[model samples]
Target chain A: MPDRVLRLQRIARATAVRAPARRPVMIAIAGDSAAGKTTLSGGLATLLGPGRVTTICVDDYHRYDREERRKLPFTALHPDCNYIGIMEQHLQLLATGEPILKPVYDHRTGQLARPELVCPGDFVIAEGLLPLHTKLARACFDIAVYLDPPEEIRRRWKIDRGVGKRGYDKHQVEAELQRREQESADFIRPQREYADVVVRFAPISEREDPPGTPLSAKLLLRPTIRHPDLSKVLAGDRRWTIHLKLDREENGRPVDALHIHGYAPREDSQEVEKAIWAQLGLEPGDPIHTLGHLANGERSEPLAITQLILLYHMLDESR
Target chain B: MPDRVLRLQRIARATAVRAPARRPVMIAIAGDSAAGKTTLSGGLATLLGPGRVTTICVDDYHRYDREERRKLPFTALHPDCNYIGIMEQHLQLLATGEPILKPVYDHRTGQLARPELVCPGDFVIAEGLLPLHTKLARACFDIAVYLDPPEEIRRRWKIDRGVGKRGYDKHQVEAELQRREQESADFIRPQREYADVVVRFAPISEREDPPGTPLSAKLLLRPTIRHPDLSKVLAGDRRWTIHLKLDREENGRPVDALHIHGYAPREDSQEVEKAIWAQLGLEPGDPIHTLGHLANGERSEPLAITQLILLYHMLDESR
Candidate 1:
């Protein structure tokens, strides 16, 4: 045989030997209600290609339905409101590339749906509150992220999502927010510290720019894992449109902060997007259109970029 | 002459024709008291080389002494408390590379000590509260940055600086912060919207890491100017440690966010620093040791990186 053919056969034999033992990469996206967790994960799913990615929402692990939850004094954010043991076991299964019958919670109807059979794909993205709240749950994932939109912005998003799609009226949504505020503070927000990355979507303060302007994002990139280097991409201009700085202090420790301008020229953003796509070892023109999109179908460049970064983590872990 | 030397001579001749008309690059660093404005400016001065840079403090424009100000209902943050007209004129002069006899404010004694000769250099960094508060002052700067440390963190920093350096007790410092709160809100903070960059130093929330842990920084880089491309630098790892994202919304517009991890390995930060230095066209291994050190002599990696980004702006403008 030719040397090249022999080399290829040797590599194929080695891959075949290792293929059965390789586990799928697991990612956890932990956040409060209406924190855009679904939007984020859906983008990643589209980017990774259907059938290659499996997504699970841990909200399905709730032991109580809406009516049942309403009867209790505790909010859905409480750990006791969830089937913590089952969720933990399923996560472990997914981490190990095992199949599981996963429960489903229909947010629109606030009811428990039929369990669905899920086989671990090349990638698994588990998003919802409390995913990173437990040690075992956290250990099951190769990467953990927390979506942390500002309260005011999040409240606005929740009100819109609740009233528009979830059958909640303005007054009802406000009351729910007020009721859940304590639980969110007590339980949900605390998960941020456990995350390797915290993504926040907030309005630019102090400016009177008109509405419909894309929202800005502040990413707190903790050093819990190895991150990509962006220095070369930013080497050309010294302007602040996109840049990196060390985080001041968080939980008494120093972290890194990454800022991206919503108004950055399309070309600049494209360069960044292409770079990130390349990091995934994917082609430059791969479909990223779904990455920064909003529920209304309007594209949010920031959201897309945020999802791309998370996708990088998942792909990196698989490598 | 040799062809290379002849080409250089021709270029030098072309440059001389444009030299007299070129204006010095002006950078404004505006922030409330103890916002680390001086430290930030000082770092830039060292990086750009002292002889090529001039540092100005607009706080010198205070029209009243400390005791005299005590009798008034207004705080120094109020425009009425300052020589707004003179500050405007001086800014214009400095922007045009002219000189002024600038007034001085002695924070230690709470007095106007002297009026000194001030000459603008190739690079001028004006740091103080309210530099971007007025349209004319804003117009004078090639780059404008507003330091926006969190109120809680700022209060703590003010108390420390006031007690340790300015000879004020805890109660006295607290009283000053309380007294100035309204004016700071009304005047100083509003200037942030006009800045090209808004820098905030904050501790990691939620967990209690340790006191000595490095702080994280969030820099809101507005799209007022063209910025550098950093996609290549971040293209490799896909890790969250150092990365950039498009901001969700700022003033109803999109912005870019850059995050750097303080806990990142030295090699990682060095890559960023080297990239920025290359953008500035500076030689590698140039002195940056003095960049991130604080007033107390302890170094903060975040502060240093922040200073470096600002330096890139200055050097870019000068080029």
Candidate 2:
């Protein structure tokens, strides 16, 4: 109970420490592992140009590394398995446009690596499994996002990354995922409600898309904060590529659901991107050309559009 | 310059957060490696009673594990080799009677281990190589102590601990100490100037003491903070076990140097302890009997007296 109260007080202090004249616009992209958080964060950082954005992985605050975690009863998804307090403290520091010496966890080698000094830039993007896990952490962000990929799709992505890159076998990956299911459901998924934007990147279920087709993004923009007038710029999709519809929330409140189709043409998305960039009070000369490059050297127009929408919030908040 | 200024501001915040009804009194015991830091800190914790004190070794904030450090040009004593920024921040947090998820650097295995939650109790003793290395960090403590051992004794102590317990050969320990000497002089020794009390434990020079004789202590009580009225307490030292002398600082400023002899019997030292404990407004029972227990199962009367003086300062600040 004391910890809870202490955290509450710290949250108040975190919100109150906005005195820095050029504080970073803090953004959180929180999701379960393999939920496209890194991809989205990287795209945004690239879009903002060199040194304009500092990206942090809250997973670095893991209480245990991969090897030691195997001995634990719970997976990393459990809040107990991570240093949530340190993550919250670092978030509070960075949100105030201050610096932090953040811990490092090496996912590939399953070891805790050396820490690094992180100085906030014009924008700070914090992405990890639990950036929005606690209210204290979420309170430190100017905008919070949650990735909500379909379970099946996220499983496939995890297996591919775990086996192809992280030196884990398919069975181990599957078993770990199974062990984490309850935790993810209990802890990770619940954070979506706290996010201002919930992004689900998956193939359109109704479409008979081929294996190589790009994934679409469904973004639920909550009214907890003001969002971009995306409808104004996205009125002409030419092919019904981008559309916004008024959706009802769980509490019967009207929310905005902006869908960007997988097959959005580069030219059409660029038109919309240019419009959003111009809204930032800057010249829209290819401002966000590098918004959606996937690790496998593929392009996803939906990812680009989603990033631009987030970028719009980032710039809008700074104004 | 910005980091220094930021640290300064946070230091102010740290000191200003004394509104808690039971804020922990912070004390720092800083010195080079194998400087009896853990031993001193453990004794202080024991004397303070169970659960009433929290001991923190700031060395846990090491930026790199021992293996990685071997490849670096500087030793762990170098400020850059540790997370000085995070250490300062965590000190600020803990000094404010707040909880912190502190990182762990395992000296035994030379690996970065899992962090632990530290909740400040009635007393917080932070002992490490660099707790007083920065002015900002030093400002968080109510009482600051620097352990200054003669080079020969410190070397022997390090080699003994390193080779016997930490799995290092004598040659390796000596080589590492040689590599660290420059950094120790440049970074570690300079912190002594920032301390309110400097403690030097060594054999009484020119005395015909045997090898088994416990080391005596010479405490330079700088006027940066008020010192207990030891002259009053030592009006009758029986056999001159404890004495207070007017000392001169480098700039001819008057300082107090209290010297306690190793040959002082336990009974005489207890008298001094009783006097100091009475000053704390507590009943002088066996309040400080557990102090000065060395690692080799031996006890030192001088150590007991040193800890009692420090406790006087800590309790006085709380009052």
Best by DockQ: 2
Chain A fold similarity by TM-score, each prediction:
0.90, 0.89
Over A1-319, each residue of candidate 1 has an lDDT whose tens digit, in order, gives: 1332344335434544765434688889999888989988988898787789989899888878889887899988899998775677677656756566566677877776545557789998899989988766777777889999988878888999989987779999999889988989888898898889988887666465476777877788888887777676556572345677786654688888877667666666767777777766787664877678798878777677778778878777877
Tell me how far the alpha carbon of residue A129 in candidate 2 is from the true structure, in angstroms, after superposition. Answer: 2.7
lDDT (C-alpha, whole model) for all candidates: 0.77, 0.81
Clashing pairs in 2: none
Assess the local accuracy of residue A292 in candidate 2 as a C-alpha lDDT between 0 and 100: 79
Give the 10-residue window scoring lowest on summed lDDT in candidate 1 chain B: B1-10
Which docking class does model 2 fall in? incorrect
Give Cα distance to truth, residue B23, candidate 2, Å: 2.6
TM-score of each: 0.47, 0.84
Supply the global lDDT for candidate 2. 0.81
